[model samples]
Target chain A: MTHTSSSGTVRKGGTAKRNGRGLTGLLLVSAPVALLGWLIIYPIFNAVARTLFTAGDEGLHFSLDTYQRFFTDGYALNNLWLTLWVTAVCAACLMAICLPLALYLRFAKSRVAAVVQGLALFPMFVPSVILAYALIRTIGPNGGVDLVLNAVGLPKINSPYLTPWGPVIGLVWDNIPLTTLMLVAGLGGVSDNAVEAARDAGARRFALLRYIILPQIGNAMLVVLSFTVLGIFSAFTLPYVLGPASPEMMGPFMQRTFSQLSDSRMAVTQAVITFAICACFGAFYVRSIAKNREARR
Target chain B: MTAHLSRRGLLRAAAASSITLAMPRIAFAADGFVNVYTGSDSNISDFWTNVILPGFHETHADAKVRVVDAGDGAGLRAIADRAMAALGTDNDPQVDLLEAFVPDETEGSIEAGLWVNFTEAGLAGLDMVNPAARQTDFDLPYRGSQVLLAYDATRVSAEEAPKTWDELTAWIHANPGQFIYNRPDKGGSGGNFVRRAIHEANGRDPRKFTLDNYSEAYAAETLPGAWDILKGLAPSLYEGGAYSSGNTQSIQLLSQGVVTMTPVWSDQVLQALSMGVLPETTGLVQLQDLALCGGFSRITVPTNARNLDVAMQLVTYVLSKEVQSKIITELGGFPGVSWDHVDPALRAKYADVIPATIPTFPAGDWDAAINDGWYRNVAPGIARS
Candidate 1:
């Protein structure tokens, strides 16, 4: 009976220690929660409220007029759609390029690897506007490309640098380095032991990669993918400097609507739309992580 | 322990209360700096602050002029839209004096109610501006330029230079591939040249077209004429007919000897000449007479200007003879106020690169030149031929 009582006492002591640790964790996390609430949640709430409810002659009214205007306005819808497609293309292209580089960096060990990695990141170091300007001069008609092309007997192609593709190319150029860096870090977390085990089980190289390597790093891979999506989605400066007047991407469209048309309400509405999409993508990303974790378990 | 707890609570409350009280003052003081939006280059902005604002400050000592460079002409309009939105509230505006394209004054500002009408501002010496400037009520014509042909004298001789439009067209055809100009819709200089061709085709007067009387059908006819010329000239142009987007690109084309000549603003040529981007032997020339040319940029006070008197004074000073001369000589702009004897130093400095000056076709004729079978009917036809 005395031994049983001692065991009960030990259990009680363990419960008390856990409760103390929980309290400390709560205090630590509260600071971040407060910061996020102030910077992100509060401003978003204010921007939405300012857009939806304008003080008018008839008193305050909640309305969907701004959203309606954004959709029905021919240019607005066109630009919004264009922004969506272009961003998707950019994100996809960046992922395509980065994933391979990341995988190679994870597996390979060569002096050239570091050099290639450094060069990939160089575009990100240059300011987006400056990069756009440099690209225009290098590839543009009056720029060096034309000078070289002329010598090669090619007709001077007017700067292909003006197309929507121009901005996309720039986006990919910049994002490749960063995305690759993040992805390389993520891929490194993948277990070599898993791949070796699968190969020992008589799996082929591709099958081992598909089954073992991908699963081990699925969580980290999701994180990289979400970041790639978000980075391409909200990119503004490169597109703003290099893009044509009528690109249908979200960043330039929102900027043009706000700065070109004096449409604050509409701009806010567009920003809301972007935030909503990002939030949705974020939710999906979280679901992906959870799904992968559950599958692994 | 009880005393310590109470003292700590008191100190926290005191700090919070002080911060709350100080917040509004900080916010208020942040709005004290006035924002001026200008579409001019960084060099121009520096000139304004360095040369012009100091003169104003000597008189009003307390006022400070803060100039924000907003790209070039198109960018100015975009910035105006942004600043207006930011300053939509009645409390304070984000911008005061606007240095923007003259077209936006008529096309956008009046409709948006963003501009301050200077009629009742009691601005002294307002009437002293030239008559051509006074015609456009919203436009305070600060400077102007003509779109003309820029050619490399080293590549093509004066004897080979086409003097008239017909001769130029024939020469371009015979040469089979030598002309270069940017897309007319994109570049002002190219658009000017296209319009000039339209005027020549229709034989229309230049000074009469206005909002009062505009004929879209006439423009439709005249514009296609220019397009046709472009189609024909396409083969002869630098590429199979692709074009650059702006003056800078066109100038680059000329510099590279890609095309013997391309349409350019006189100021652009002068700027390029000053920058040593263009060879010393390069020169610019206007079409003989009655070409489409009424280029000007304007500055106006926003409706929400806090210091109207000071802003008005700043505008007056910018348009003053001393300032205009400085801008013309040093900044590579043409003087808008009057064409007086230039400084000898300036004359010597710019002797090799003096732009040929030409009078705009009279305003009435200008209308006829643009609207009545000028740009639409004539330009496209010339391009095809």
Candidate 2:
């Protein structure tokens, strides 16, 4: 988020004097880079180091005991599997929901499109804790929905809160605005003239979408998927508050292991494993961005 | 001065990086003063500085006490270790008095005689304190809080409310979707409720479990039955076994009349009622068979305390009827002394919050095992997809 906003400012100031621009850019980049290395990279190395070595009867020796325990422990593996499943479902749901909204906001010339776009983006401003609390009150048992249903003579609604469905619903809802924005940006390349030409060539709506729109928006959708998967995989508050107790997402599972179980080593192991999985999506994102930059050049 | 400046500069850099550096509550710990280190939260620190210390000052005007906040008992343990190290050596531990200190926090503290024996000393007001509140001779308990069943009296009748763990389980089954407890790992209310379940499962005995009794094999044998008991009772809970996230949320559910019963702290419920956040009919009760767990704040002075005479004096003063009432009305905690020994008016006001007995569970290895097992076997009957 900081990167996007800072890059926007740099672009606005592009007409600055060309001489000493290298030094100027270096000065501008150094603070954030140094901060990231100190705050993020150092902690990552420390966590990984703690997991790779174990203090034993002999001495502080290199060992994989915690990683071994995590792999052999059915409970730990189940948590990992649940995290992956939630991330996958959230990614799928985000795309399925956001693509439609983005398309409507792009093509629909109605005045209501502005309202729809604003509604889609509103969740971005609401903090996740507030959003989760609102979701629980609105959908959980004997909550607002049940109150209304009872007043009108209907059965109580079966709540998704505390089920595996809970975090999925929350993550999907929370990620929609960003996903829509990204897909809409990608959709900018799908010109109306191109769609018109495709239609004039006797193409149906589905074919126009598949041939003209999807090809242009494919990279944006990938970016959205990669970011959503990474974010949802490591989310703590929503899963800790809303997800089921058993078979937890990795974020809550690692925290509970460290805090409740008082096993810091095991918690670090779980984190390293989670980081290894997220690295795949992260690598894909970086590579795609690099490839995009290369294509533009 | 240059070295001091560099140290302060480094500390500032670290403070700028981290969001919250727990600033010491009272900072002037000068030489020749009796240093008091307390391991309680800011509220109890305020209690010491405002209520207890001011009263002590009237008796000993010349003496000075400097208080330090040792967050969550770690500071007290660090002092105990320092005291242990200083025994028979020509070094000063520099720790004079401790509040909210647990003697068992450090290994060998008991055998090493690291603390002054409270019972053996026979302080002036020790006779007034409840015998049940005393855990060991090494520590003096001055304040306490218990988890009780917070219920809406309008929905659940006086006779209908549960008095025993078994009765509570039956009531939950009979009136499905009317009871709630927060997840065991989230709050003490639910954690103690789960501990009560474990006690019930293991032949209704609290003595079988001890601070040092936890083992993987023992937990595997004992906790499976507890998981079965909790899992069997889960379907009858509010919204088919959905637990509250914390003690406050559990009471929130009760306040909304969605749940008739939940475990809550005595102090919190009373405060909430006084604040008009909950209905007037909100009542608190304790389970009879084996009571829910509660935490007691105990003070332990080291055997080698420099101001041992003054420390003993302060203990007796804090235990007196006057301060004990302040414990109730001001601090919102139970008096370390019995109800009959405290101020009668304040006693009458807190009669509803008082329990016949408040048993506590240890929070170390056993706590971890029970909570982790609960998450694994009790909370989820649904298969992992």
Candidate 3:
């Protein structure tokens, strides 16, 4: 009877300890949740609420008016279209340039890979404004590029870097290194044994690349693509400094509207549209990752 | 099949997500000194901060002014809005005074109730200021500035340089891809260039710029001519369709021999010359009829000014000839008031840099064409090859 009573006491004590541990776990998670609510949740709520409700004089109301202006305004539409074209062109170009570099890094000797890898990332460390100024000095009209082009019997190059192309070059310069790094990490995950297996089966190199290698790194490509899209879409520094005053990009437009017009609502509206576009690209990324995981399984 | 189905399902699902980000406000709240928000250049800001402020403080020992370089007029408007909102009250008014460039921006500020009426406080002193400077009701006269042509001597001689709009266009046609200027909508000087070009083409009275007189219909009829002229010369621009979007870039282009000549602010050209950024051979000339002219800046005491008496004293000192001379001689801008009475030494030192006479708007009509988006309509013309 005493033994039974002692066992019951131990069981009750064990249950109490487990309950205490559960309470402590809840307390730990509460901190992050509170922080996120304060930092993330509060601002978004405020921005949306403020933009939606705020009204100004002279036919400027909080309703769909700002969005209306965005669609109808020739400047805004042209810029948006321009931004889309630039971002698309940049992504395709980055993929073309970075994929090869990433492949080479993956296949080359480790020492060579490390050196090239460091050089590739060198562009990333330089600020966009600094890089822009340097580019203008080098490739701008009468810049070094022109001098060299002339010396080589080539026609003197005009400052193509001044037009919309200037920002595009800077964006690519800043983004290619990062994309290359991400792609290298992705390509590295491809198993050598799998590559060898395909080779042993008499698969042509092209066929193996198209099938085995591509599928293995498909998720990584998606991730890199998404990052490139975001980088181009949200980039302000490069475009702000180097971009043509008539920047077609949403980033510069939003900045101009906020800074020049002092139109907060329109700035937020453009921000929303830009974020939406970037988010769609992000979704593609997430979907690719999920597909890769399923394929592996 | 199961994997494919799961993948398709995942793609079909749309989930919502939110992210929040905050940008830090720039420097705020200094002690002893009043925080001034101005759109003036760095050299002038330095002059105002170092010499003028201290000189003023000499009389009123307790008074100190801290100058915050708040960018251009449009940029200053944005700063004023942000600073005021962050302070959560206009009662304290984050900036004591705003020195702006564009009249429209100043008009916007007045509409926003950010400005105090100066018609009552300093009318007598302002009368002593040049008629050109006192004309703008929104601002006190700081100085009158204008765009001038700067040319590379190696590429183009003084005789080869176009003295007028028609001559310039002809010269550009004769020498294709040898001329450049900033995009009009982007740079202040570019706008001046376009406006000047239009006014010169029309040969119409420029002083009548109000919309009632300079109607949209009139703009539609005449602006196209200006656009056509600019577009005709566009092929002569560097890269055909690409032009530098700013004065610095245009000057840089001139330095590189990308273009033989470009339009720039007269003072900017002078400052660049002083800094040895441009070759000694570069020449500056004011265009005929002057398309753009700098206006006077004013210091108004906001109705809600914290230190009203102190603000008046500051304004009173800023308007004095001694302060104006310091502003002009050191800052490289013409004085808001006539420096006819300035000491011979001071005038002699500033003679080369300062214009003997600064131009002004004939009346309210000067910016009428711009109000109708005349500059912007013609801007793309200069961009087309």
Candidate 4:
């Protein structure tokens, strides 16, 4: 009876200790979870709810008219198309340019590589508005580029900086650093030994890259592409300052609809649409992270 | 038992200290201070900081004025949205006074009944204010501005400059990439130009468009001519027909000698001249046939304002001749009151650029509709090639 009582007492103590630990854990996580719910999740829920309902002559009723208007309005639809087109082009261009450069920086030990990497990263320090004005000064009429062309006895190249190409170039310049950094980190996961073995087994440079490097960094590429799309999709400053006024990017279009047009419902609908589109890429990002964690496990 | 009593005592002391700390802030809020929310445009905010507030402080030594710089358009909308959100709630609005361009800029809040009626408030300068400047009895006109064509006198002589809309078009065609105007939705000057163009193109009476209601059928019927006119001029605009984004950009292009002329606000031109953003050689003119749209800046007190009487007194002082003349002389803002009430010297100073007839802006909805239409019908027609 004494031995049995002693074991029973120890078991009770263990249960009480576990209860205390569980309470502490709950207290620690509850604050951040509550904060996230209040700040981010609550606002999103409110926006979506507001878009789905409307107050009319009778009372609050379910409606899809706002979303219908967003999809049907020619101007809004054109802007949506323009936003997608610009974002897709920018993402593809960024990957094409940054991937090779990132790979080179990953393997090359030369000082020139270091200098190139530093140069690629330099634009991250420059603010978008300042960078826009700088671009205007360089490519505007009779600007530095024109002066250079004039001195070299060549016809001045007409500036494409004020068109859709303007924002694309600016987006590419702004995103190179982050994309390269992510990609270079990703390339680190590719085993040097595997690359060497492939090369020794009669694999050429193209084949080695196709079989070894690209496959290893697929998750990283998805991550980089997803972020680039999100960044370009919601970008405001460069597009506003440099791009055509009509058929504007989603950011400026939403702003004008809300502030200039004073159509809050339409603005919210547009915002929800933008969020849904970005969420597609966001899903990929989340999946990549989950997969990465799974791979590590 | 002793430790328990001490802990309870400590808790009581902490609670008392917290209440004491919050009491002063509540008292300060009740101390009868006017909170003014104005646009962050340097022309508006700087004039208040450097002139109006200082002058008001001299007369009312005991009163305090706090100015908040809510940015233009988007910023003002944010403020209005916040104030509207607090409606029917227990919380009072944080703002007392709102400063904005009349009609179009303040329409959202006005429609929502966020502003108190100034006519019943017994404002001082109501009689002296220009009838054209009075949007309604509820709107108190504080300052005025008119859109005008600003040009580089060194590049184009006064005799060479276009004097009518038709002449201006011909001049643009002749000069190719030497003239520019911003997108209508971006700035009041550009919007004014677009409105004027629509009025001229349709051959409709400008007064008909000034009513508050917008008819979609009427706009659909009349907008094609305006679009056609805009399309024809696009190929001759600066940078191979791509218009600049905003008024400031057009001004920048002019300052850089990239363009010979562009539409700009008369008051902004004066401000830019003083700041050396525009050369002294820059000349201003109102087209003889087309009266450019002009309007007054409005000041309204919200219903939830803390110091309602003091806010009224502050606006009264702003409308007085001493302040009006100072605004005209320093900031180039036209008098909110009639010329008879303005100082004669100030009246003569801006005589050259002031229009004899000011064209009224279209209804708020029409203004937005026209801007949107420009983006839709007109912008796409511009030959990018």
Candidates by DockQ, descending order? 4, 2, 3, 1
TM-score winner among the candidates?
4
What is candidate 2's CA lDDT for residue B335? Answer: 91
Q: What are the lDDT scores of the predictions, listed in order?
A: 0.66, 0.82, 0.68, 0.82
Better TM-score candidate (1, 2): 2
lDDT digits (tens) for residues B283-366 of candidate 4:
887777866777778887776676777788888998899998987888887888888888887678767755566777655677
Q: Is the docking of candidate 3 incorrect, acceptable, medium or high quality?
A: incorrect
Model 2 C-alpha lDDT per residue in residues B186-294, reported as the tens digit of each score = 7677888888888888887777888888789988888888888888888898777787777777877787778888998777777678777789998777887778888
- TM-score of the second chain in each model? 0.74, 0.75, 0.76, 0.86
lDDT per residue for candidate 3 within B4-58, as digits (tens), equals 6666577555221111121123224434347677776665677677887888878
Error of 3 at B167 (Å): 2.1
Summed over model 2, clashes come to 0
Residue A206 in model 2: shift from native, Å? Answer: 3.5
lDDT at residue A209 of model 4 (Cα atoms): 92
TM-score of each: 0.69, 0.77, 0.78, 0.85
Off by over 4 Å in 2: A1-20, A57-60, A108-111, A191-205, B1-142, B215-222, B298-332, B337-341, B348-356, B382-385
DockQ of 2: 0.23
Best DockQ among the predictions, by candidate number: 4
Interface RMSD of each: 12.0, 9.2, 10.5, 8.0
Per candidate, native contacts kept equal 0.05, 0.44, 0.34, 0.51
